[model samples]
Target: MTAIPSAMRVIDVPKPGGPDALTLAERPVPAFGDDDVLIRVAAAGLNRADVLQRRGAYPSPPGAPPNPGLEAAGTVAAAGRNVREFKVGDRVCALLQGGGYSEYVAVNVGQVLPIPGSLDFIEAASLPETYFTVWSNLYEFGRLQRGETLLVHGGSSGIGISAIQLAKALGSTVFTTVGTDDKASFCEQLGATRAINYKTQDFVAEIAALTANKGVNVVLDMVGGSYVARNLQVLATEGRLVMIATQGGAKGEIDVLRIMQQRLVVTGSTLRTRAVEFKREMKQRLLQHVWPLIADGTLRPVVDKVFDLADAPAAHAHMESSTHKGKIILKVGG
Candidate 1:
C-alpha cells in the first residue's frame, strides 16, 4: 500500500469558552513508533476531559499527543513490525491519552482493542474511555459486588451510562441520578433499577428509602464539593466511594468520623496521566472479561448523538448543555 500523507485538524490553544473553543486547522499527521500502529480514525468520541483540555484546564500528560481527544475507533492502516495482535485493515478502537481528534492517530498497540462485531465505528469509538473508566472505578476500585446496591451520579453522562450497564449486568442493583426526566427514563431502559431525577429528588434520601434504608454499597461520583458529605450519608458500612471527576468543584471538608465509623473506602483515578503499563494492564483485563460481554451485545455504548468531524464544536456544545443521554461521537471520513 502507498504511504498516505499525514493529516490533522488542530484545535488552537486557549479556547476560551463554548464550542468555539474547538476549531480546526490542517496539519501533518503523526507517525507511529515501533510497537505502535498507524490508524485511520473513522470517528472519535467527545469527552468532558476533551472540553476541559481545550480550555487549558486539563493539562496534557508528559509525552502525550497534542490533540485533545481521549478515544477513537478506526482501522489499522499500518502496523509496526513488533505488533503481533493486529494487522492492516483490522477495525479497532483505542483508549488514548490524546490526539484522537484527527484524521489519523498513531497509538501504542497495547491501547487498542478489537472492535466488537456488534458495534459500528461510531459506537466503538464511544466505548473505550467510558467503559475503561466505569470498570476501573466502580469495580476495581469501589469493589462493587453482586447483590449489592450501586449508585451512579450523572446517570445520563457517558461514564454514568457505562456504570449503569456494567453494574446491572454484573448482578448489582443499579440506581442512577439524572438531571432530567428523559435522562431518568433512558437510564431505566439501559437497565438501571431506579433512576432518580437529581434536579427534583434528594438522591441520598431516595436511595436510602429505595434500598429500605440499608444504603448503597458503592457510590460512583464525578460531582464532588458538597456531594462528598452527602455521599457518606448514603453509603452503607464498608461501602466505597470512587471519585473520577470533580465537576462540582474539588475542595471541601468531609466528616472524617463518618469515614472511619463506616469503614468506607474512598479513592479515584484519572486514566490519561497513568503510566503506559497501567493502561496496558487495564486493556488486557477488559479484553479478557468485558470484551466477551460486548461481543455478545449485553454491553453496549449508549450513543446520544453523532456529529460530523467538522461539527465537533457543536458536539462539544451539546455535551456542555448536559442534555445528551449518552456518548456523543464525532464521525470522520465522511
Candidate 2:
C-alpha cells in the first residue's frame, strides 16, 4: 500500500439539494476504537440514505464523519488493539453508520463480514446495508414465513430485490410494485410471483386478485405517503407491514379503523442509530444464516451501476433518478 496518510479523499455535502451539492475533499482519516478496524475501501455502496444524507435530511449519526456512505468492501489495512476476528490484509466489507464514501474508513470489527470467495468487491460492497436491512425487517421483525404471500414496494430497488429473492428462497409467494414495465420485468426475473407496474396498475387490486382476495401476509413498504392506507387495505387479516423508508412522504393520515379491523401490525426501524451490541447481533445472525446462501450463490447482491470515487455525485444522481435497478456503488481504490 502507498504510505498511509492521516487523511483521504471523500465526498461531502457541500450544501443540500441535487448532485451539485456533492464535492470531493481531502478529509482526516477517521480514528478507530480498539474494537474497530481500518479498511482500505475498494468499493462503496450508494443508498437512498446516502442521498438523504447529502440533502441534509438524514444527518450523520452523532460523532461520525459528515461524509456520506453506508457500506463498503475493502481489505483490512490496520486492526485496532482489541480486534481479533480479522487481521491486516483480510478482504472484508462492512456496514457503516456513516463515512463509507472515502478511500479509507474505520469500521467496528463486528460489522465487518469476510467477502465470500464467490463475490467480487463491487458485489460484496452492495450487500451489507440492503441485505441487513431486508433480513432484519422482512424476516426477523415482519415474521415472514413459508407459503405466505408478500408484497414489496419499489421492487427494483436493492432492498426490494433482496426481499424478493430471500422471500422466494424461503418459500413465500412474492409480489412487487415497480414504477415502469422494465422494472417490473426485472422484479419478475428476481423471482417475484407477480411484478405490478404501479404507474399503470393498482398494486392493491392486483395483489388482492393474485391472492384470491385473502390478502398478503406481509408488506415491505418504503413508499410511505398514501401508501400507509393502501398497505393496510391489502394486508391479510393478521399481517405485518415493515416500513423502511418514506420516499412517499413521512406524515400521512392513516386509517386506524382499517388497521384494527384487519389486525395489521405496522412498524419501522433504522439500524444506524442502534447500539453497537444490537448491530453486532445482527451481523452474527447474518453471517450464520445469510452468509451460506451468498457463498453458495443462492442469494447475491443486486448491483446496478458503479462510479469512480471522484464521480460520487454521478452515482448519487443515478440513485436519485430512481430509474436504476439495484444498488449503485462507488469504486474507491485505483
The alpha-carbon deviation from the true structure for residue 146 of candidate 1, after best TM-score superposition, in angstroms, is: 1.4
**Residue by residue across 170-249, what tens digits does model 2's lDDT show?**
89999999999999888999899899999899988998899889999999999898998899889999899889899999
> TM-score of every model?
0.97, 0.97
- After superposition, candidate 1 runs with Cα above 4 Å error: 10-16
State residue 305's C-alpha deviation in candidate 2, in Å: 1.2
C-alpha RMSD between model 1 and the true structure = 1.3
Go through the candidates in order and give each one's C-alpha lDDT.
0.86, 0.89
Best by TM-score: 2
80-166 per-residue lDDT for model 1 (tens digits) = 999999999899999998888888888899899999876899999998998888888887889888899999999988898888888
